[model samples]
Target: MRLIDSYRDKKTVDILLTQIGNINVKHKYRFMEVCGTHTMSISRFGLRTLLPENINLISGPGCPVCVTSQGEIDAIFDLVKNNDVIIATYGDLLKVPGSNGENLYMLRSIGFDVRVIYSPLDVISIAKNTGKEVVFLSIGFETTTPASAALVKQLVKENIKNVSLFVMNKTMPRVLDFIANQKEVMVDGFLCPGHVSAITGERLYEPLVKSGFACVISGFEPVDILMSVKLLMEQVNKGKFWVENNYGRVVKSNGNELAMKLMYEVFEDCDACWRGIGIIGKSGLKLRDNYKEYDAIERFNIFIDYDKSLPGCRCGDVLLGRINPTDCSFYGKRCTPDNPFGPCMVSNEGSCAAYYKFGG
Candidate 1:
């Protein structure tokens, strides 16, 4: 059958659902997908409604912007407010409210001089051409880190001094470890993120599998998601835990080594704070000492007094899979994309945003 025809084939979905129902899960299984894109796609396709009631899917700390600490946002604003510096960041990060009802986009509107760039490469060009101190508000997972690292390498090669990177890069493994240790939530398995797996590889998730939880790296397509759920159910029924790569076409065991090498060369693991989750050790990436010249924090001597999240925001619980979007008192009420109370509702990849956009 053609790709378009197959997607609309309800019979195919019925067969998959039937197979899923036939497989004895033995115990209740809760699988978490730690990527915001995964959450959006799953919701958009109504994947949750198709699953067995016994099987639960939860959203994790996958959205980079949503998980970014308020202190970091404050720090970015600190840099922006300085007349000597020009801030460059992704568009989605503009609306994430910081401590004191301040956001990058708001600062920009008030003449703080913030420019949104689609790619780090663009920021590099901007830095090279302008005399102003350009700080790229770098934030993302492994997928976006390589490009940021590449830009750093280019700046070093060209001996550019104006460009600096505020590295808020997060790794998936450490965050997953933190989530597994949380007693408030129980995750039986993980539908690993495809883009992140493509950078860190399937091997990186070995520890999670060894801990008796099944890990499957699946794609965003409907069939891919259904197939992953079926595979997880089969593994749970058989009393087996392993890392399975359902997205074999894009992800490999070792992943993109070149990208990994670039990341290590420029950044090192450090203790970084998540907005509501506090600090997770070795969860964040910072610029290496050798490349400190390109580090934004050091270049600007930026200091941020860590700010506590606003009251009535359950973003921390939402990110840790302990609560869903509806559980938050502010969800779809006081908080929304237009008037966000927390970063979870502000970011495009956030679970609350996904639920609001698609029908939660």
Candidate 2:
């Protein structure tokens, strides 16, 4: 409680805000938060409104659920139609809109079997009890990949044959490089992800900083975000590009070795597509050769329809920071959380969902 409260302390928040306000900066700054949790916290805490007008905070492809390509979503539904594998997924992926607004939950309501689970470990009971193959639709950044890796090793150790992971996990460093190098986008700095930094370490962002962007790994609290902003403003004022860790409590210089080792043991880097962004090579995770038996994609031989986004849905552009959620024609009217036309509105961590739900 003390640790949590200390980060959220009003006095600290005020001090950061005052320090940030004291900077006589005149230029417009765009800082993208590469974590969905950070986006949600900024929106939930109304930190964006409190920040200096010169500093603009935008959402990135940080929401792993939001960035999941349409092909993966369609393939999951296609798997359900085959009646061979039981789809076990985490929460957000279920309702995320796919090609033509089809989702697992929508199909489940019409009698398709889809189960929401909290962790990859839960699939053990699911596969054991059902005798059918369980395809866990694994998705997320480095933070969640270790759990999937651990599950694969556990399956191999226990000789559990009924479960496999349809791994759609992504890497952060390469994608950040992709985003920063885009000439069309103007990103002055990055509010890097805390959890990803905890796994990959602060050095993961050092290359991007070297490429000329002020980067800061931030905690989720209001004060933490504000402090990061102040730090970024300082970077901008000094015309310096660098990386800093405002979330020092959780993130270390080198990050967690065990989690990264677990991930490296089971998965290898692969070229993967982002939802709005095109294919980023070596930006995805795939099962290693030894773990091929536990790979759902290899086991099932999946195919996708390759659907395109519907009209007036700027979700793809939103993911790239090309525009804001409010800029979308379907934002508040045609598209919403209830009847989401895009994945951005479907997931709670999505930028569109954050804007709509919290009125930020």
Candidate 3:
């Protein structure tokens, strides 16, 4: 098969690797890729093995499903168990276990209604076709919030009374400052998410640069990743910190204004808990007061009274780049992907899953 994009070509990667190896002496650097897709791509392409000895790439709390707090999962479980509601959610979330070791998938196996959907608007079809009530499990970063917003707008247009949203969506830029100021560990730079940056813009991450952290918006392709790393290195070499976009083809200075407008139209910023990274202020998206009628949390009276990850799961340290997935005692023993004990093992974009697939 012919590979259309030569970014993955061995020759190109070798050249970039050589250029990286010849850079002048500097302090050891930790570049955190704050996108789960970047983590998966870096592992899949064996990019880590080819990196210069001085530059270490760390994973951040990027995977939406993995970072979803246990309490939220339990709350959704409660909604399904106690209320007459059917859940429409992405397939990845179906198997993510809550506090009781049950997930949307297991609940479905026992005859609870949890429908896997590729689009948030699919809930409208379920509501329109069946007389039953439906709730869409909305989850993701800025890239996905627009879709949920569109769904809610459609609900208002069609006057769909039975469908509502259980919003678990989050945003990225607000968390960067919180992470940058942490005393436990320090990141030398950031490889921002192209997917999110396309919606939020390169400017959204300017604050990190202002705080003296080198930031670069990067794409998922191998060439893209190398290009971003190269730019970050240049920033370090000159003792300069600024926001740059290596993936300018998709990202813009201001980002997609229409998407942002639509997103904020129905959702408002709120403090949210990241499974491993603790709660950060205004990092989560919840329905606006005007959109409360479309909110499943209010409609179902769901209470996430409990919120705690499984004991001994070192996902917190793993996310902050303080430890590797293997550092956890249960990583390979009790936390294999087939039967995961921690949230990180369940998502393909998760650090543990990446280590399991591509070696730590």
Candidate 4:
């Protein structure tokens, strides 16, 4: 079978769904796919409707913008207030509301010096040409860390000091461990993200599999997703749990070693707070001490006080996989995408956005 044609093949999807229906989960097993792309794919392909009724799939704290603490957003907004410094960030983070009624994009329009860039390379170019201080709002999972790390390495190679990184780089494994240990949310298996696994490899999720939860590194194709679900169901039925790689075409045991080396060379593990999930120890990547010259937080001396969310937003519960998007009373009413009440509603990878777009 041709690789390009395999994704759209109806027969393959039907066969996998049939196999999934045949498998009997000992009890109702709830599995969570802790990746935004996975959540988007699940909804876009109508994969949930094809699955067995006994199995439940929940969206976790996968969206980086959604999981980012309000304090961090406030911190960046604080940086924006500095006239000499230009704030550069991805587009998704523009609308994520902070403690007060301020966001990056809104601050930008008010002449706060915020700019959106597609990649960190743009920031490097901007810093090199302009005489102004540029702070790259480095936010994302493993897929994006390499680019940030690469930019840092570029700065080091050229001894550029004007460019800095205000990093909120999150590790997926640590956060997954936090979710696995949660008493309230019962996740029997995980459809591990394909892009993340491509960078970190299948070996990263071995601990979760050892703890009796199946982890399948999956691609975004419809067939890849359906096959992953079927594999998870097979593991559940036999009372066996293991880390499997369905996306063998890209992911490997070691992942991208060069990228990992670059990441370790430039960044150190530090504790970071999720918006609703509180702080998870050693789950975030900060600039290493040797690379302190590129640290925006230190350069700006910006102190951000801890701030909680507004009264009625259920983004915390929604992020932890405890409830669906519609479970919130303000889901569609007060929390539409145009005027988002929470980060989950604002981010494109957010469960609320996915549900709103796909009729969940």
Each prediction's number of clashing residue pairs: 0, 0, 0, 0
Ten residues in a row with the worst lDDT in model 3? Answer: 1-10
After superposition, candidate 3 runs with Cα above 4 Å error: 1-4
- lDDT, candidate 2, at 162: 87
Q: CA shift at 39, candidate 4, in angstroms?
A: 0.3
Q: What TM-score do all the candidates reach, one by one?
A: 0.95, 0.96, 0.97, 0.96
lDDT preference between candidates 2 and 3, better one: 2
Candidate 3 lDDT by residue in tens digits, 1-360: 555367677788788878887886466878999898999999888888888778899988888888888888888888888887788999888777776677777889899988988898888889998888898999999999999999999999999999889899999877777789887768889999989999988888888888889999998988889988988988988888888889878898999999999999999999998887778889999999989998888887787643577788888788777888888899889888887877778887888899898875
Q: Which pairs of residues have clashing backbones in candidate 4?
A: none
Candidate 2 local lDDT, 79-156, one digit each (tens)? 888866688999898788766778888888988778999999999988889978888989999999999999999999
Runs with alpha carbons beyond 4 Å of true place in candidate 2: 305-307
As for candidate 2, its clashing pairs are none
Please report, as a residue range, the 10-residue window in candidate 2 with the lowest summed lDDT: 304-313
Per-residue CA lDDT of candidate 1, range 1-360, in tens? 675566446788788889888777456779999888889989898989888888899999999998987777777776777657888889889898877787887777877778889989898778867888888889999999999999989988888888888888998888898888887888888899999999999887888888888889998877778889899877777778899999898999999999999999999999888867888899999988899988888777889665656777889889999889989988899898899989889888999999888865
**Any runs in candidate 4 off by more than 4 Å, and if so which?**
none
- Tens digit of lDDT per residue, candidate 4, span 1-360? 787687869998888888777777456768898889888888888888777778788999989999988778877777777547888889998888877767776887877777889989898878878788988999998889989999999988888888999888898888899899998998889999988888998788988988888888888888998888788877877788888899999998889998888888888899888878888999999998888988888888978655656678888899999899999999999888888988889988999988888855
